[model samples]
Target chain A: MLRFANPTLFLKLVRWLLPLAGGAGAVLLAWGLYLVFAVSPEDYQQGATVRIMYIHVPAAWLALSCYSLMALSSIGSLVWKHPLADVSAKALAPIGAAFTFLCLVTGALWGKPMWGTWWVWDARLTSVLVLFLVYCGIMALWTAFDDPARAARPVAILTLFGFINVPIVKFSVDWWNTLHQPASVFRMGGPSIDPSMLTPLFVMASGATALMLALHLAGMRTEIMRRRVRTLSQQLARQDGGS
Target chain B: MMDTPHAGYILASYLLAGVIVAGLVLLAVLDDRAQRKALARLEAQGLRRRSSGQTGEQ
Candidate 1:
């Protein structure tokens, strides 16, 4: 793992892993969607609306997972000062924001038909909104600084501060009385979902995870190249100034 | 499910997710190409990265 701290070595690894992850993501998503529509049974109450869960649940899970990843990378940036750590964290912001946005939108879509409203100020819902806002804030912070190196420490600090929301977002469903259902797939008593539905949900989650990984790798590669460009341009400026 | 009463909502959810995912992929790919091009242009201009040898072939 430490071997990956070198950006060049990391890029070499990404060259191979990116395509593999993207391919696996595509295949798994295709298979998962097939099962979602044709194989999984509808909820006795929600009917076809339950089909939305196939995507919603996975998006929700990924949103939380993405933040957790950012927090971990932020730690690396601050503690170990891993060179690729800030790059990894920076790259993940927009992707994590996208997933969080998807989760909210899908949840709203699912809500309208089932709850008869587009949104509510419930604990689970509101905390996720806060999570989305944090993602946006981190992205903005990355852009606020002209120098990537200068931005790294502050961004990592903000990320760690924002991580308080992760546990809040996860446990909100249980900690408070909310419309969102509590822990269907992950719980002390094991999953309450039928195997048929559970299978597709897990498959979709895996696919989304793979796709996120590919995107993050691509983002990191671009960031590394970007830093190099900045350095070269600075060097050119210095040379012109010297001459 | 397309014919179901809530099909529109279901469709919208999936469609929106698709669009967002596609947008992210496009951003990653385009940003990558742009940076690579900028690096090539800089190198062509006789500017070499200070750590060029250590970084290996990108």
Candidate 2:
């Protein structure tokens, strides 16, 4: 993992992996969607609205997972001072934010009928909102600095602090009396949901994961090129100044 | 399948997810293409990367 910190090597790996990720993501999503709309039975309670779970759960899970990844990258940046760590964090922010944002929106849409409200202040919902805000804060911090090198440590610290919310988001329904449902699919005892439903959920998750991988790889590649451009422009300026 | 009372909400959720995912993919692809183009342009203009060490201009 550390060896891939070499930007050139990272780029080479991304070059091969991006297409595979994208292709697999598309295929999984198609199969997942087919199962979601055509094969899976509706929730006895929620009716067709349960279909939203196909997207909402995976997006929510990925949102938390992405932040955890960013937090790990932050630790890498601060401790190892690995050159690619900050780039990984930066590349991940908007993608994670998008997933977080989607999760919120989809949840709200799903909630309107089931909960009879579009929004709520429940522990799970609120903490997830905070998680979204943290993503935004990290992204804002990234652009706040003219130099990414200077931004690394500050973002790293902020990410570490924001990470306090991840577990809260996970266990919120349990920790507090909330409208949100407790874990059914990933509980300690084992999944409470029917296997038919569980199958589509995992498949959708794979699709989301692959889609994220493709985007992250492309973003990382772009960031590397952006850095190279900055370096070359600086060197050109230096040459001109010397002449 | 589409007859459920909550079909609208389900559709909205799926549509929103599709849009967000598509938007992210577009941003990543565009950024990658733009940066690669910029790098190529810079190299064309005698701005070689230090590591590459292949001088583009005399």
Candidate 3:
């Protein structure tokens, strides 16, 4: 991680990893889908509807985890002045927003059949909705400012401050009175969900994480290039401008 | 299982995955090309400035 503080090394590392991550993400997702549909047994009660969890739950996990990653990177940016950390967090917002949106959409689909409602204000659901909005606010703040450095301060503060919500989202179903179901995968004793259902869920979650990594890397690369071009253009403008 | 009849959920999940993943891959490819092109332009511009500077000295 420290080695990447040097831009030259970081660029080289990203160059090699991007293609590998993209290829691996594609292959893993294909295999994961096969396992989700063909191999995993259908739920006795929910039937094929349970299959939504394969996508929904994984996205929900990533949506939460990505924000944490962003916050942690922001802290590194502030404390250690780690080069590219802020840029990394800034790049992650849109990807996390998409995952959060996916989670909500799939959750609603699952809810319509399972809970008899498309949009319940369940504690878990509402908290996650807020988390998604927070992601949007962070992205907007970063782009709103004319100066990138000025933008980083407030955006980093907000990203770090919002770290409080990650645990709340994880425990909202259990902590408050809500219609949403409690933790099944991360409970202390064991996962309450049966193995038939759990296997596909794990496979899909793994695939989703890989996909997010690929997306995050690709987005960060674009951001890096954009910054470089902006710098060059600014220099060119200064040289050509009249005295 | 048979009585529930929930193929719609499965279809939706597959469709969403296909759309999102394909869209991301397309963006990555296009962004990579755009970045490379911009970099090339900057490099050419830099070289042009240096050549002009050298000719002015001569």
- Candidate 3 — which residues are off by over 4 angstroms? B1-4, B47-58
RMSD for each of the candidates: 1.1, 2.3, 4.5
The C-alpha stretches of model 1 lying farther than 4 A from their native spots are B54-56
Q: Which residue window of length 10 is worst by lDDT in model 3 chain A? A: A4-13
Q: Mind giving the per-residue lDDT tens digits that candidate 3 earns over A85-198?
A: 887898789888888988888888888888888888888999999999999999899889976667777888999898888999998988898988888899999999988788
Backbone clash pairs for candidate 2 read none
Ranking by lDDT: 1, 2, 3
The weakest ten consecutive residues by lDDT in model 1 chain A span A1-10
Look at candidate 3 and tell me the lDDT of residue A183.
89
Q: Which candidate order results from sorting by DockQ in descending order?
A: 1, 2, 3
- Candidate 2 CAPRI level: medium
For every candidate, what is the interface RMSD in angstroms?
1.0, 3.9, 6.5
User: What is the alpha-carbon lDDT of model 3 when measured against the actual structure?
Assistant: 0.79
Q: Proportion of native contacts found in each model?
A: 0.87, 0.89, 0.43
Clashing pairs in 1: none
Please, what are the lDDT tens digits per residue for candidate 2 over residues B1-58? 8898778888888888888888888877788778777788878887767576443211
Using DockQ as the measure, which candidate wins? 1
